[model samples]
Target chain A: MHDSAQDDVTTMTFEAFADTILPGEKRFPGDVTVAGVAVGGGAVASGAVAVLRTDEGGMAPALDNLAEALNGHAGGYAAERGLSLDPAVPPFVALSFADRTELVARLTAPTHPERDIWVSVAMFSTIAFDAAAHLHTVDALADGHPGMTTMGFKPPEADGLWRFPEFSYGRQLARPHPDTTPSGSPA
Target chain B: MTAIESTDVVVVGSGFGGAITAYHLAAGGARVVVLERGPWLTGQDFDQDFKFGSSSTRAFDFTIGDGMSVLAGNCVGGGSVVYFAAMPRAPRFVFERHGSIGRRMWPAAISRDTLEPWYDRVAEALPVTRQDWSDVPYAGGLWAAACHHAGRTANPVPVAIDNERCVNCNWMMSGCRFDAKRSLLLNYLPAAIAHGARIRPLHEAQRLERSDDGGYRLHYTVVDDVDYRVEVGGGAIDAKVVVLAAGAGATPVILQRSADTLGPMPAAVGRYFSGNGERLNTAVIDEDRVREVLGLSRSDGVPYEAYQIGKGPCVATWDRLDGSLPEYLRYSLEQLYFPPGFGTILAQVPDATGPTWFGAEKKELLRHWKSWLTIFTMSEDDNEGVFGPPPPTGNAVRVSQQMLGRGALRYRPTENTLRGWAASDAEVRDILERDGLARVMPWTNDVVGAYTVHPLASCRIGDDPATSALDDRHELRGHPGIFVTDGSAVPGALTVNPAMTIAALAERAVPAIVEAARQRGVAVRYGAPAPDGATAARDAVLPLVAGRAGR
Candidate 1:
């Protein structure tokens, strides 16, 4: 899928980057529907990415830059590790989950130029994941956003004001806890 | 630039300092206008959802122009909106220290006796209260128990809250949606508004210039958005008297920008910045385990059981520092509470381990988010920071980096302050470990150069014009009509939350401010003066408290 503003190549690269950061066991539940389109709970969280790109433009350029530099990152990692590559240039988006993880770890090493790129990706991915899990309501059970069920995170609602009738609200000076028994004093 | 609006007095903040100043000045019959850089938020604006709540009400959204971060309130009420409603006065010893024989007449010229009346007045208005230990949450009880086990006397910390509305949600940092907190938004501001004080929110004062009319001209831009994008029309306000109450971090920047017009200020203008020796520590105590240690037999006592997180006042401090300092530099402890999501974030990174939120490890931490507790320690700190114009680079990112880089390179914690923090941490560690409550975790960030939410003492008030920014009257040493009434004017570290103290100083500064404006042919009258202006000045000051200039 692609928009006129964003090409298909950049979109796919972003999705791959997000999946590596948050590989949900299941799709997030899609409780939210826009224009009758049920949103959230997908293996590839395009909604999260779109929201993140809209909110934080600082990370948007890195998405495309990372895609363009993926081959360089793979080659440098291979050379540093003294490993030979099966293909001289591997497609990062098409790499297996294990290969992608290895590629990412190397790209984000302290000395690597792509470290900031990975940081931007990780930050956006988490924000998108949280938004999907917390915002959706309708297709929640069927949708596979693992963060919701696994972490037991719930969306906020108007539950009414919290009431503490027992509290005195400092009408008078409060004495210390009666249960406070000094270390050397009698229990 | 739009035409400048003229007024009798223009206060540059709306927190405790500005709010109190505006109320008193307005009551004194002067036309008072207050400019706040942040939004004017209402109770309905605050949310419990972490992201929404923080962005809307809790977060200050300011960086220290360095990598080091600072936490302050960015709403209409300022720090009072987000601070733990605790309102303990500065210890009598602090006032006496400046008046004592060895360092007599060196630091602050004011004494405790002069401030005692204003303290009582402020306490009555805010109506500070000490909570019954039974009313606090599980965290409070745990802190009390730790204090007892450590052989330190634990007393109930006083809070300024509306008992009728407080639910004790423990989300005080996020702003009180219930309007339980007696912040300036609820009290002083509204009173000032009723007395003809006009508050202009989202108006950030960028610089100041001496006016042709001899009053100060405050140049400011309206912040259409918090991110500094999309600016509206900019304007200036010409006031007979200008008071700087933008807190410690920002007040110095305002003054620095105005130096060309206001003439060279004392070298001490940006010097003496401090963090009030603030430090925070935490431990994850299993509810069942802690209860059992306290000899409470629950119906279903199980180890590692999670308890439902509820809200209450966030902090309860102990007055005595125990052995945290060498009989002089005092330390105090306050229990800190966070929103559940903050708890999750805190749990995710135990020791800055890289990315623990991917697989089962994430689930394990999120499951027990309710079991975490944070203990914060604050000690007296030396004034040790400087703020000036961002380098010529004009890049916001680069400026922040340079500020933090320079701050890191220049800052060296004094031996006494270091020993104070070390002693405070040891005391907290002893409390947690002695009872075997839970694992005491190491700090995720550097403890020595840890960033602080409480920064004070940038432009302190003193008798000497050469060494201090302001005179004993809280007026700028060289500039007569300009004044400072916020934490920037605080002479030294109070070693405690400085909200109440700031308000008390504002109360004390109002009389001189009104008199100064009146002398300039500005009739500064309270709503309607009592039979006697001097006596009325003594009573409520209606807002100003006039006192002996120097001790």
Candidate 2:
């Protein structure tokens, strides 16, 4: 885990986070393999609980990390940043922020490609969800920090989230949901 | 177990204004509840296919903007979801109106200085860019030509989109065929949602009632569009503040409902209304120039293929002739509007009625696609015909709106508009002739027609309560915690797209609202104080390009 101020996420044991935060009970599926987690039926999710089920074995650690992440988000200052694929908030998970982002490093490493990517993506999505409920708008983090644009870093994508069809293209262009056309182009 | 409802700000009509306001307010730590009357559409749902466009039908939702009344979007992303995505700043005269909101306009609204930061913020976010100087029927070149012909440099239009994805599909108004336009649906709204704001779509704000504790009450309905599987039912929301950003037409309507509950609108509430009457004129170029310049090939052009014009097609052709537009006026310009290079082989087929004339046009004898350039003209509407004194017998309540505090006062059109000063017809005609293009038929008569979908001034901002409705800052004169920041607050029209102006103004107004809320002793929850040093430096030192004078 990074420093408390840097990243509040703790390395939780996956089982605990799922058992406590995610409601439905299930075992890690014994099928499918990636870096190496069976994909079949071990994970269980219905609504908000699904987010909890993303990280399988590290369940408790995931919960602790998510909790610490939530604690870091004081109010609506930042949103839960996560990958573009997470589900909408279902009002549970006790989140304060709304921002989301999918951190690819956690659930699936580049070396471990899995056929059922949803499983891993889903796991990371919960991290973002839990984070979002706790975080503020990214601007909150941006405060006092050097603006990326001024520092020659490219501006953030226009739309932070992916609109359904072009969600895959989010990082490629300025907010895939919004087209790159100057106004007056047809939808 | 009763319905849990609260609000820092209650934004009505989630179009450009509402969506933006909600997002910013929520981002700023205010509990914002956005009320949108239309169903939400995501890119996946609104496939960028012509077949989808042909199959899907949309409805008319209107909004008022600087000096004009225009169509508005109603989805969660607000107007950006369905906007043309152009971000031209409001014309100079628009910012300095003489009568209502001009001199007395809110101090924060527009100043080379005040708008500097905001414009930078919005422009960067939308990537509002200059026209591809090379595109045929080139709007940039044409404007330059017209300006040279008129003594004004061509006013380059600032667009709020990623130009790379502009498929030149000619379906801008139909919706981005490609998700290229950086509309709020794809930008601000998502960010706001990410920032904790709650958006309730398909929720039409029917009334604004006052709760027993004097908090605000909003009653809205969840409507269902039978065509779409979307269901909407937003019960009632009680909030601390109410922001009316329903654009031009609907702002007055929402206030009308408030009038029933809050009392007679402040003296200037719904007084001055204007529709920046926008009319289009054009020159049909030799099919070759249209294709070559626009980078489109006519032969390979799809039948009935559309072309791109500046601030291209958002409004319908206005012929004011008491009948449908004559054919030459309707399709001629549309056919010739695209430049020559895109799919050039098909675009310049030379036969208006060729077998390849696309879709049903083949059977209908439609003049196939050609390339042309258009001159879009926006003029002020009649104030008397539009803006009038508040009616005597409307539902009058007791607003106690006694010009209570210092805010925007007057609600009148800008000086230039009031004087009916616009680019001369002779100048326009001269530009047409100089360009070697002729106004083909019926359109010739329609050039003089005053029409537009962008409406403005239904509620002009001013400082004195007696003379205007709200003060310049758009804070309604008497209504505590009530503000109007969207198009409804703009007094006049600009030569460019108004959405950007509205969004930028909203950006400026946001901090003021936040500060004011704090001053009024309202509880603010911005989470732990944004750390002391580095992060604060970043936020404080934003992209501030100070003086971007309007051309």
Candidate 3:
């Protein structure tokens, strides 16, 4: 188990990593974990950390190690570029948005030995923002998930079913089978 | 160890192959026992969420191999429970086509003409129907329109779904929550159960050994339904006949493991694998282009908006298998729709001016998520892939514990396959660009490798035991009572969804299996009457023609 201070750094590092992929505003005032770079809710705001912590995510056990690796990679990246690092916060969290993006690109490059791990992290981050993989579908829609809302997903009707009587092509291409019942099943 | 149970025939899966075979055999008065490795689930247990975890009844199971990733269903109803329900028959050429080795991949006995009766049998059981134009979802409509612009014809692919119950929720692949789709759970399994075929879900078949009574003994493990954790000791069953329908990825592993006790399997046990040239690509249509395609006038006063892709069934294929195109170039492009959650995970649209995966450009792409059209392409390819023991290093999934190591699939697309994909991609680009497009993106690349839901012909059936695991009669070579009748038995790529073809092959092979069971004094009957609604469903889809002509 990680100490509380180290855990906080890991959380901050993950937040920075997710925000770089799908950047968003800070969750609250004095929230240094999230980089307030973009306009709307991004992966961080969409519960990236919470998603990663889920048992189904399969990354909860490796959170600290991944954060440490990110920081180590960030350190090497900074040294190679002769760039100064911020003393405050973790190395990955301290880097500028542009530098963070470049570092991620390098990590996820085709020939990278650990590319699959980084790619998985990136996919999970994206999944959090897109599918809300950690949440129940109906509950997420009821709570107005930012990602689902942004994507303009159609919600279920009052009876919790989707019924589209309108034809997509504006005209019918063929008639329904004679055996088709009023309820849409073949009799 | 638990006391061994006895049955007349033991079927080792619950997918279309196993379920159909069980239904027929049980109806013929044979005591059938179906041992499914996954859990028995219903509509109430279904969800639209993308489940990637290892669950006993997850809608789909993914096995990452050496050069490809395989997607398969993991439930009582098997692939039928999770597939899109498109039931197109393999064209005549698919059966007659020769491989690069100058030999026909499929046996001369198997052809569209020969399989048509069995295909008709499955169609009726599943009650296959062609989607009416009114039922075509917006994404399908857009695809048809694009095909029309490209001087090609797009038709509604024949499917095994009830048109009325489907609400166009676009959750077909995740398993239908409304029980709208005509999965085997809705038809064959229930009929098999009614005929006294006992289905044992969560029973994972481990190995096969010859029983003392000149029958077969199937060793299996009973797993927890929730997490699929194995229990202690496991169990075994004795049967006069054992039918291996555990799918291409799994059946081969089982046979390979049984080799130690049952004697060495033929060399062709895990050869001739094919992904059916499956590829996923997407094209995002511009908003203005979308309105023009929909023929919206300025005076209509409605703001122009792109169609909601997730408002209908998963696929409506644009047929390009006509004789005009070369065999290598012939392919079908099915319009695909993913539910919003799964769709967003596939939102990586490459752009020349910006980062492909992240940044403002990606966010913008997400905003128009409804406008993006996903195309699932399938074409003819050489069945050159081989399933074998995993390498000493690298990533691979152990499909079965008996595999010793991971069940590795070594496949690199042949030059012909590469040309086919290129030709298909070029056609898609031309079609979409002519109408105007933001970006056309393919899901597979160097890093991701190839992904296929239709993995077929790992243990193919042919006339020669040197080149095929099973005889033309669907029996394992040199193993009289053991049979393979699943995607594994399909001799080559079908150039379409393999479900109907796999089911048809099983249907055709059942009579011979029944005769063998009868000769072994299992008191089996043959030519059992079709279950209720079988004739009606068959008559609805069959027009006495093979392939898409009936559709």
Q: Which of 1 and 2 is ahead in TM-score?
A: 1
Alpha-carbon shift of residue A112 in model 3 (angstroms): 2.7
Candidate 3 on B1-551: residue-level lDDT in tens?
A: 55789999999999988998899899878999999987788887776554334222265565656566677887799999878888877766677766544677677788877787787788777777766666676667667666665666566667888878886666677678888899998888999999999999878888889999999999888766544433544788999999999888788878877887899888888788888888777777776765676443222433223345343333333356654556677677777765543334444566636567665567777777766777777887777688776332211333222111233777788898888888877777777777564468777454345767888888888877678888888999878899899998987766667788999899888877887798788777655445664465345324432232112
**lDDT of each candidate versus the true structure:** 0.58, 0.42, 0.72
Q: List-wise, what DockQ does each model earn?
A: 0.14, 0.01, 0.31
Question: What digit string (tens of lDDT, one per residue) describes model 2 on residues B1-551?
Answer: 56858776788867666766676567656777888765666665553221111112232332222223234454556567656665655433344444433343434345544664566556655556654443322333433433344333332345665656664444455456467777676766777777787877667676677777666788776666432222345577887778887666556666765777877777656666555534444444444433343332323452112223333532211111111321111110111222211111111112333212111121111122232344455544333214332222111111111100111112333444433323323345554454443332112211111234456666766555665576766777767677787777765544345677777776656555655555544555221111111233224323331221000
lDDT of 2 by residue, A6-110 (tens): 222332222222222112223344311111122211112212233333222123234544444433331222244322321222211222112211121122222
Worst 10 residues of 1 chain A by lDDT: A31-40
The predicted structure with the larger lDDT, 1 or 2, is 1
Q: Pick the winner on TM-score between candidates 1 and 3.
A: 3
lDDT by residue (tens digit), candidate 1, B259-331: 8888987777877776777766656675666667754322344332222333433334454533333433566
Q: State in Å the error of residue A73, model 2.
A: 71
Question: What DockQ class does candidate 3 belong to?
Answer: acceptable
Q: Output the lDDT of residue B254, model 1.
A: 77
- What's the count of clashing pairs in each model shown? 22, 157, 2
**TM-score: which candidate is best?**
3
Ranking by lDDT: 3, 1, 2
